[model samples]
Target: MKLAIVAVGHRQPDWISAGCSEYLKRLPPEMAARMIEIKPEPRGSKSREQLLAAERSRIDAALPASVRLIVLDEKGDDLTTLKLAGRLEQWQADGRDAALLIGGADGLDPALKARAAEKIRLSSLTLPHGLARLLLCEQLYRAVSVLKNHPYHREG
Candidate 1:
């Protein structure tokens, strides 16, 4: 199944891009894991409401119509690494393309959260949005590894 990571914000630090690319390259070509970064709203002197609206608009426009949406939220379910691996397996078994949404620093808009098919949280503590993206990508790679019976993931 195709896996897409649809996230807000662009022009991340070099390290962030390097880290994400490293894991993404390790995945098999058939899995088709891709990172689609929706350009962040220009942050000049815009009001809070205007900024949020712009962010939402960009996110909405970047989302592909066919993929199932899953948002990463602190308020969402926190699953173990093994459970996440299982979840990915189930999605593939069910023949669904998964799109994971990572919102901006202010967090996801209420409408986006409501529209998600599933909501998952990495941890209770807040993490930098860029770091979160890197973490998500790594976890997805690990999940794929586990699903394929690769030696990358070892059960403890």
Candidate 2:
């Protein structure tokens, strides 16, 4: 199963790219994970709705057909690491590609969130876009590790 992280914004800092890359490399050969960076709409003088509308279009354009969509939002369900690992395993078992959507600075539009198959929150606190990407990559790696019984993740 292919895992795609389709997020708004590009040219992330070198550290962010490197951090995410490290985890991406650790994913199992069968579960190929890739990051698809979409250019965020310029905020400029545009209203929040306008900005989100433009971003929504870009996100929709990047989405792969037949892929299950999971939107990351602050108001979404908060999941434990083990639960996340279970979900990842289920997706792989079902042979479905999963695309995780990360919105830009202004956050995701309500309509877009409504369209996702599932909505999950990484944390209650608002995270910077770059940091959020890094965190997601790390958690994905951790989930893989847990599923494989790798020493990288251990329950206390």
Candidate 3:
């Protein structure tokens, strides 16, 4: 199974890159994952809606073909690590590639959110794009570890 993390942001702090890289490097080869960063729309002279729409268009264009769309949004469903593992198992079993969409600061477009095959939130609280990217990478690695029964994952 392949996973694509398509996030709308560039120029994240060095710590975020290091953290994300660490988790990405830990992922096993079978569960291939790649990150695609989309340039964020400049907020200058643009309405909130316009920014969202611009980002939405770029995200739509960046999406890898034939992958399930899993978008990140504040109001989306909450998922536990185990639940995510179950989803990972299902995706792997079905040989499906999933595109995880992380929107810009203004959040996702309403229509784009509606189109997501799965809408999930990393946290109830707001997070910066860099931290979100790092956290998602770590969680995905944790889910893979659970699937493999690797000692890296410890259940509470």
Candidate 4:
């Protein structure tokens, strides 16, 4: 099953795109993944709920069919690289596509988070959007490396 990262904020800097691309290309076909960027709703005067509602609409539209939904939240459970590797292995074994949703600056709708199969926190420290994207890609690659017993995962 392929993995899909549905994130808000479309126009990431070149380095962010390049960094994500490098790791994503390294993933094997069975763990193939893609990112879907949604345009951030204008923040001017809109309520948090309104902003989330607008963005969620786009996210739902972009999601692939029959995928297990996973959300990235600051308050979500922290997953170590090894744990992520185990989770990835299980997902692959299940043969179900996985969709990881990364919300806008305000984060995803509460109802969405509640319904997700899992909520993961990339870090305990707050990270800039670009850095967070890069880190996520890097970690996903590291997780895959661990699963395949590649030296890359241990080299660091």
Among these predicted structures, which one has the highest TM-score?
4
Ten residues in a row with the worst lDDT in model 2? 105-114
Best by lDDT: 2
* Model 2, runs deviating above 4 Å: none
Per-residue lDDT of model 2, residues 57-144, tens digit only: 8888888888888999887889888999999988888788999999888888777888888999999987889999999999999988
Task: Please identify which of the two predictions, 2 or 3, would achieve the higher lDDT against the true structure.
Answer: 2
Which window of 10 residues has the lowest lDDT sum in candidate 3?
87-96
Worst 10-residue lDDT window for candidate 1 reads 47-56
TM-score for each model: 0.90, 0.94, 0.93, 0.96
Clashing pairs in 4: none
lDDT, model 4, position 25: 93
lDDT scores of the candidates, listed in order: 0.84, 0.90, 0.88, 0.89
- Residue-level lDDT of model 1, residues 7-121, one tens digit each, is 8876789999999989888888667788899877778998766776788888878777777888999888898888898888777776778889888766777887888889999
List the candidate 1 regions with Cα displacement exceeding 4 Å: 44-47
Query: Residues 44-94, candidate 3, lDDT per residue (tens digit)?
Result: 999999999999889889887778888988877899999999988887887
- What's the lDDT for candidate 2? 0.90
Q: Across residues 28-94, which tens digit of lDDT does each residue of candidate 4 receive?
A: 9989989889999999999999999999888888988888998988988899999999999888898
Q: Ranking by TM-score, best first? A: 4, 2, 3, 1
> Which runs in model 4 stand beyond 4 Å of their true positions?
none
